[model samples]
Each structure stands twice: as structure tokens, then as C-alpha cells.
Target: MYKKKYSNKFSVAPMLNYTDQYCRYFYRQLTKKTLLYTEMITSQELLYKNPDNYIRYTSNNQNPIAIQLAGNNINELTKCAMIAYSLGFNEINLNAGCPSKKAQLGGFGACLMLNPILLFNIIRAIYNTVPIPISIKIRLGTHNKNNYQHLYNFIKLVSKKNYCKRFIIHARIANLNGLNTKKNRCIPPLNYKYVYKIKKDFPNLKIILNGGIQNLQEAQKHLKIIDGVMLGRAIYKNPLMLCAVDQKIFSVHSIINKKILLDNMQKYIHYHSLKNIPIIYIFRHMLNIFYGKPQSKKLKQYFIHKIKNYTDITILFQKLSKKFNF
Candidate 1:
């Protein structure tokens, strides 16, 4: 499939520590047709290390998958973008919005906001080399809301070059001094109005709102105003929320059902285990699938620590399903 057809309008945000290969495979199974993204992989990590294990995506699924690359050096990031393109990713998202000390020290992530010129060049290089759609994911501002004008200017430059198809705005500021990344995700008040303003100003460019969106109702609200909405922590903790995505967002026939979803999860677990991924890596996220069901607390607690083998985890899941009459 080509570019426009891959943009599903609603997607699960790329969350670190949570959206790994196994997680994407499982999420793809549950959601059936939604776009899935790999967690942010630094260009340095991809080039200097073995990324095969990290960036694996099965061709059989043919799910619309995007790879997010974060780095500062223009040459390194461009090289990584080429690598991702060569690997057949439908889209490549540059991470300009992570609030972490390490990312700052690396001279990338939210810090890229400071050097929009360099970012422009990086985007230009990626666009020049890769035929896939290129996009930017960023926060509303780095330190002050007033910097939005600066962001708008960057978007103007990118759009003027016809290099960027979309801009995903995480409705929060990066507090470089006081807050950690998790706190940054929560402590900063989401100002969707700022995003709405961007949408109004740049009618030619697609503006995507991300962060703090929880359910389909909230997604519908944003979809009415912006081009798209991205779900992060909410989706990871409650992945079933995406089950209705095809019907709710894409206006497509829905193939997602509870039984089919579980079978899909089991299939991925088997595939991941064959690849030597630990059972806990797959089971840790599945525990949330049954979240809020009767006996969920007990089952979550049991699986959280009691899981020692794949067979035992499968048995416990079966027992929990029976206990909750699922």
C-alpha cells in the first residue's frame, strides 16, 4: 500500500518501555486494522547496534507500521531514515517532543525545538532520500506557550517545501529543569486550543492532537476539530479501547471482536516466544486487556508476579477467563 491509504486517522502513540515489537504485534492483533508505531529508536542505537531484534515487524500482518527515529546529528538521523525506508516502513516520524534529560543531553528530542533550522534540514534530507511520507511529532512548546509562533514558523517552512504531510502535536510543554518524562506527560496542562489554532492557521497541513485522550468519545471530539488523534498511555493500559477504531474513526467495517482478539493475542504470544521474547514481556500487557473485569484485581495481581512460565501464564489466563465468565 502507498502513503495516503496508510494514514488511518486514529492511532496508538509510540510510548517508550511499553510499545515494543511484542506490544505492537499484540496491539495489531487486537485492533485488527489500526496503524501501529514502534517505540522511538535513536539513530545511534539503530546504526551502532543490532536493531534487527528491536525493529522486527512481520510481513504477514501487513499492518500499516511506522518507525519513529530520534537523533540530533543531521547525517546520522538521515542515515537512520534511509535505513528505515529501505526496510519498507510506510512512514517515518521524527521525534521532536520527548522530555527527558538523556534526550536533551543527546541534543535531540524536545531540544530540537530550539534549532528548527537543523530540524528542517533533517526533514529535507529524509524527504530527499525516502519516498515514504515524513512527519514530525512534537510538543506544543518547549518552555513557554509563546514559542508556539516559533513552531508555527517551522511548520510553515516544512509545509512550504512540501516535505511534511502531517504534524502531531503533543499538548504539553517540556519542562527542561524540574519535571521527569512521566510527570511531563501528566503535570503539563493540555491546551488543545493551541493545537486548534495551528489547525486554523495551517489549513494545508494536517495537524494531529495527541496526549491525554482516553476513549472513543474523546477521540471523536478531537477528530471533529483536528486531522487526527493519538492515544498513548490510555491505549497501552486499555488496548481494547482501539477495538472500535475502524468503525469510529475510519468509517470502515469493523473486524474486531473479543474472541477473535484473544485468539490473535495468543498467536502473537506464540510467535514472540519462538523469537525468544520472554513470556512476561507479552503477558505483562495482556493483563491490562482483562482490566476492570470481575476478579480483575486478583487476576492482575496473580499474573503480575506469579507468572513464571508460559504454560502457567496460559493456564492462569484461562482460569481468570472462566472466573470472570469472559
Candidate 2:
């Protein structure tokens, strides 16, 4: 049912602390067809932390979404995948590409590439349990080595018996030491060839290219070689790009206006505010809505001031529309 409405050609990466329920709500208003990913949740968190707060979603036309989980334990990963499947998520993606310090300490993320068996077990466990598809996000290699053969072998071993259905490859090697995630993303050079080669080798496997793709043209170029494209900061920093992506790349014709985005967000803001959810949690994301528009800085300042006393902010959009002459 959900598959009929959503497309995965352009997916927003699972950025921690950035992609949340409130943020997803905002992005959905910009483009209905693009797949929205949840922030990285660990198997431990899904079982131990309050799962409702971690994986909440407001129903809408953007029905096809993926939940990204970071963990190496087979039982724990499987349990979390089943829960996500039960919650109506279309896909459960294992976080094999995250290079954060916290992720490394937890025995998950990009470091999973070093131990293929553990990764295989986790993937197998998730795929065996739920009918929902399983995907993996991975880097070319860890420890500063851009080895193609090793990456190919890792994918080969993991898919020895058709364990995973899709693989999202970030076109850079993850450095375990010395480089933080922010630096890792930019410092390491992107090698799109490895991802393309993977597609050539694994013809039946669905391969998605990620890293450094910022515009529709770049996405279109990569699509010629791979099955899909996944983007992170490029989309978050400038969300209007997704509107272009929906229309141009995927041929999805849901062009949402800025006013409509604000209108829809008002409903979400009201519901959450009544639940005592801090107004900043939702408004902080709105700060970048007008990326290149005039009076953006002024609007951001206005939101900062209003958040101080945002008890009745349902009409915040109306105020902005009138102030900007929208």
C-alpha cells in the first residue's frame, strides 16, 4: 500500500539529531515522492529507550519511508527490524557506513566492514524475520584504505546467499582514527567508480550511490550507473532542491509551494506544542527553509525571538506570510 505512493530514487540520509519526526514532517511538505529516512537508531535504543519518541511519524501521502538501525547483535537487530516492520516502515536499513566516534565505540557503523561475519549475521537476522526489505549503508573501506577488492568481497560475503536486497555506498573510505565524521565526509576523496563497478559486478543487486551529490544533474548522472541516489547535507541544507528532484529526477510532479509547507507545518507544530514538546524542536529546522531567499536572516531572528514565548504559535505562518507579503 505504501509502496504505491513513495519512490526511493532520491533518499535523505539518516542524519542523527537532524532528521527527526518534526524534520520529516517539514520535508514531506516539500516533496511527496522522495523517501525520508529516520535518524540513526540503535537496536539497543529501540528496545531500551522509549521507542515511541524515537520512531514517531505523522501519516501523510509520503508513505514510503525507511528506518535506519545501527547495531551488530543479530538478535537485537532482528528484534528492532521486526518492530519497525510492524510499525509500517517499508524498509529497515542497517547502518554500516556511519563513522562517528560514538558508533565505533558501540561496535557498529562503518567499522562493521572489518568484521563481515557480524554484519552478515545482523543482515540475515533482519531479512529472515520480517517481510519488509533490508538494505545496508556502507563506505568503500575503513582505516583510510580505499580498497575496492575488499569492499567487493565484503558485499560478496554478505550476499553469499542473498541476505540483503539493497546496498547504499558512500563514495569514500571511513577513517577510524584521527578524523571525525564531519572531516571524514569532506577530507576523504569520493571515488564514485567503486560504486559503479559494484553495480556492474552485482547486476541483480540493487546499488545506490551516495556522497557529494548536491543537485539534480549529479543525481541524474549517477542514476545512469546505479539503481538510486542517497544524499545527506545537500538536501537538508537546501530542501527546495528536493522539489526539483521530485519533478526532474523521479518524474514525480508534486511541486509544493513555500506557503503550503508552512501551512502544513502549522498543524504539526500545534499538535506537538499541546503535548509540551518544545517549540524550538520544530522551529529550529525551519530556520533554513529560505536558504537563498531575501530576508532569510530577518526571518530567522524573528523565529528565535518567538521561540522564547511560543505558547500560541499556530498562526506563526500567517504572521510570516503577512510580514513577507506572501
Candidate 3:
């Protein structure tokens, strides 16, 4: 059990293909305090496959990271929570907000919102099995039931157990049948007001708002009404923004040095390379590191070209250092 209180002031949302262990390690180079999460791993995968494949991290510095699991089975979830806790994860987050067809077919994700009783049971089971904190990531409502009252009822029922105290609410109604996962993120209007109201009504429960949060300034404004703010594509596409997270959000001064960042990534890539992992796997996450910069396109192109003709990790970084003046 993690004895220290976990801070949810700011976090990187657990994206499907984007927030893997390699990506989390890269993000750590930019910000140390911002909480990170693993990509949503289903309970079955953790049980059937080699668990290390899904939860491996490069170092203990990745501490305070949460593992997001998607499933509806009470026993599987409880077992998975124990596995995550045994592996030293800081928290277990149930995925009740994903609107993907795959998740729907598996009887999990956003569809779990339709069965608040089962969701509550799953949360209760996991909470009982693990001493670490448990959190739920959810959408406001589903389909035609997209309204304030429905959302309130869902939270009211789920919170009745009081097993999960932290809720990460994505301020959008999931249109499971009509919208694809990509469309679900945009087409459904964000109702941050509903999230704020949740905080108002459940004053003791921690409410972390997720959806359409673009920058740290916007996050700060939401933090005034809620406990935390979660960023998804905004941070993944321009991860350099995380460099300011420690200072601006956590009030901890951190030196953002490009040289230090390069050295750390170079060492990380080299370490993975020795383990027979492809460099491209690690480098792909960094393609957007220079986002919004004047040389962003050129740097990205150079990375692609080098990755395609990948040689030694040292050679690749040396070339990048000279060509991009890193």
C-alpha cells in the first residue's frame, strides 16, 4: 500500500496507443510531478498474457503512476488490482469512459456506465483487494440520457459505496452507436459545468476534470472549481508543455534544460536497444517533442528518416545532435 497521499492536481490521460510505458518514460523527462497513467489495459489481458508486457517501466522514478484497467468482471478486476498493487503501481483507475466499439463488445468501458450497479461492484471489489487508491474515469452520460440529472444519478449511485473517492470526469456524453472514438472526443459538447456541479454536490469527493483542456492556464482556471485537470492529446502532441507543469501546477521550481532532456532520452533509448527493443518504438513518441517550434517539421522529418535507416542508437543521437543542434 502507498501510504503517502497521491496528488491528482494534474495528470496525463491514459490514451490508447499513446501512453505506453515508453511514452510515460519520455514524459517523465519533461515533468516529474505530473501524474502519469498507463494506456487502458483490459483485465483479461493482464490475466491471460505476461503481465510484464503491459506494466513494465524503466525505473522507479516512474513512481506515482497509475494503471488504468478496463473490464466489468468483479473477480478479474479484483485480481488485476492486486497484480497492479503488487507490481508497485500507485493507483488503479477503472475505465468507464472509453466509447470504443471493442470496449463495448467486451462489456466494459463507456458501456459500464449503463450498469452503475455492476460498475459499483467492480470498484468495490478492487478497492477491497488493493490498499492503494482507486479512481474511475467516466463520461458524463450515454446517448439520449445525456443530461445533468443522469450524470448526477450515476455518480450518486456509484459513490454510495464510497470505495472510490476520486473521479476523473471527461466532460462529454459518449454517443456509442453514432460516433467513433475520435468523433466522441470532439462532436459531443463538453459540459464542464456538470463536472463543477459534481464537485459542488460531493464536496468531499475529489473531482478531476478531463476534456478540451489546452494549456496550463486553462487547467489553473478549472482547478479553481475542481480538484485536478487531465490533458490528453494536448499533452501527447506537444509534450514539451509538460516542462512547465512542475513549476506552474505543483509550485515546484524545475529547470527545463534541453541538454539534460537529450542526454536522458539518449540513455533510455540505448538501454532499451540493448534489450532488443526497436529504437523506433521509443522514438515515435518523441516525434512531437518540438511541436510549435520553428524547426518542428524539419526535426520530425529527420527523425523519421533516421528511424527508417536505423543504425546504432548512439549514431542516431549523434546525428540528431549535430543536425538539429540539440
Candidate 4:
């Protein structure tokens, strides 16, 4: 368990390819208080492959971060939770909301919503194995199970042991059979009212709402009804939105200096470059750092071109600073 309790009032969703360590590190530069999550890692991958490959990029600076794991087997989930706890993660999040076919085939993700007993057992096993907080990221329901009563009963069953107290409910129903992952995000109508009702009914459980929340103002509005809000694509597309998150959402007064931000990243990239890590791995996550700025497209192109030619990163930053008046 973390020495100090961390707030989940605001968070970035664990996107598969988007929420890698580089991205989480970049987001941390913008806001210190908002909780961060790693992209979902399956239990099988963690068990069979080198766990270090999955977690080596994590830094102590990324404190209060949670590792999202996907699997239905109680023993595997418990072992994964222990591994995450040993690695000093602040929380272990079960990925019950992912609608990807890969997740469906594994008998996890959104499908877990249909098997409340097994889901509850998995949670209980993990809770018993690790002392860190355990959270579940889930949709309201799945396919025909998409009803308030069904959702209510599922929540009622899972929350019985009190092992999992926090549930991050994506307000959309996941269509496991007919929809692709992309369609699952858009085709299903979001029923935020059902989420609000859950909060009203389960006053003791911490409820964080997810899905279609776009900005801080909207997050504040939802906070009026729930414990927190989780944003995914919105933050990935326009990261600058995080520039004001600490001050507006967490009530922590802080100033973001673009120069300082770039300088810190430059140093970080250079250090990694020494270890033979390609700059593209880190730079790709940064193309939007200058978002909303004048001539951002040209800047991104310049970056891509320089990286292709293997230009010195320090020189690239000097050029960027001069060209952009950073």
C-alpha cells in the first residue's frame, strides 16, 4: 500500500497503445496530482514473458499509478496482483470494460460483467494477495445484460465482499458480438444517468464515471454526482488540456512553463538515447505537446524529418526553441 492515500478525482484512461510509459511520463509533466494508468497488460503475457520488459520504464516519479491487468482466472489474477504490488504500484485495476475481441476470446474484459460470481472471486483473490488498492474499470453492462437492474445486481454481487470498493464505470454498454473496438466506443449510447444512480444507491462505494467526458468543466459537473471522472481519447488528442488540470481540478496552484517542459524532456530523451533507445519511441508521444500553437503541423513535420535523419536531439531542441520562440 502507498504511504499516503491518493485521490482518483481525475485520471487518464489506460489506452492500449496510447497510454504507454512515455505518454504517462509526458502527462505527469502537465499535472502532478491526476492519477495515471498503464495500458492494459494481460496476465498471460506478464507470466510468460519477462515482467521487466513491461515495467522497467516505470519511474518512482510516476507514483500513484495503477497497472491494469486483464484475465479471468482467479489464480492468475491473484499472482499478477502480487507482482504489481511487489513492483510498488499504487493500485491494481482489473480491465473489465475493454470490448476488444482479444479480451472477449480470453474470457475477460467486458465478458466478466456477465459472470459476476467469477469476477467477484477474482477480485477477492487479488484483494487477499495484495495490500494495494484494487479497482475495476467496467462498462455499465454488456449486450442483453444492458439494463439498470442487471447492472445494479452485478454491482451488488461484486461489492459483497467489500474487497473491491472502487468501480470506474464507463457509461456505455459494450456490444461484444457485433462491434469492433472502435465501434464499441461510439455505437453504444452512453447512459450517465445509470452511473449517477449507482452512486446514489451505493453511497459507501467509490464510483468514478468514464466515457464521453471531454473537458474539465464536464468533469466538474460529473463530480457533483460521482467520486471522479476518467478521460481517454480527449486527453490523448489534446494533451494541453492537462496543463490546467492541477489547478482547476485538484485545486493545486501550479504554473506550466513550456520551456521547462521541453528542457526536461530533452534531458530525458538524451539519457535514454545513450542506452540506444530510439528517439522516435519518445518523440512520437510528444508531437502534440505543442498542440494549439501556431504552425504546429509544420513543427511536427520538422520533428519527423529530423528524427528520420538521426539528427542530434540537443540540436533539434535548440532549433525548436529558436524556431518556435519557446
Question: Which candidate gets the maximum lDDT versus the true structure?
Answer: 3
Cα deviation at 109, candidate 4, in Å, is: 0.3
lDDT of 4: 0.88
Better of 1 and 2 by TM-score: 2
Clashes of each: 0, 0, 0, 0
Ranking by lDDT: 3, 4, 2, 1
Q: Candidate 3: where is the Cα deviation over 4 Å? A: 1-3, 322-326
Residue-level lDDT tens digits of model 1 in 3-96: 4467748888888878887788777775656778888999999999989756877745636888899998888988988888777688899999
Q: All candidates' lDDT scores?
A: 0.79, 0.83, 0.89, 0.88
Q: For candidate 2, write residues 1-326 as lDDT tens digits.
A: 35454556789888988988888888877777778889999989999989775698855544678999998888888888888887888888999988998889998999898888989888877778998778899999997555889999999998878879689999999998879989989998899989999999999998989999988898998898899999889887887677677788777676566667677778778888789888889878877766777888887798789778665676666776665422
Q: What are the clashing pairs of model 1?
A: none
Off by more than 4 A, model 2: 1-6, 59-62, 323-326
Q: Which has the higher TM-score value, candidate number 2 or candidate number 4?
A: 4
- Candidate 3 lDDT trough over 10 residues, lowest sum: 317-326
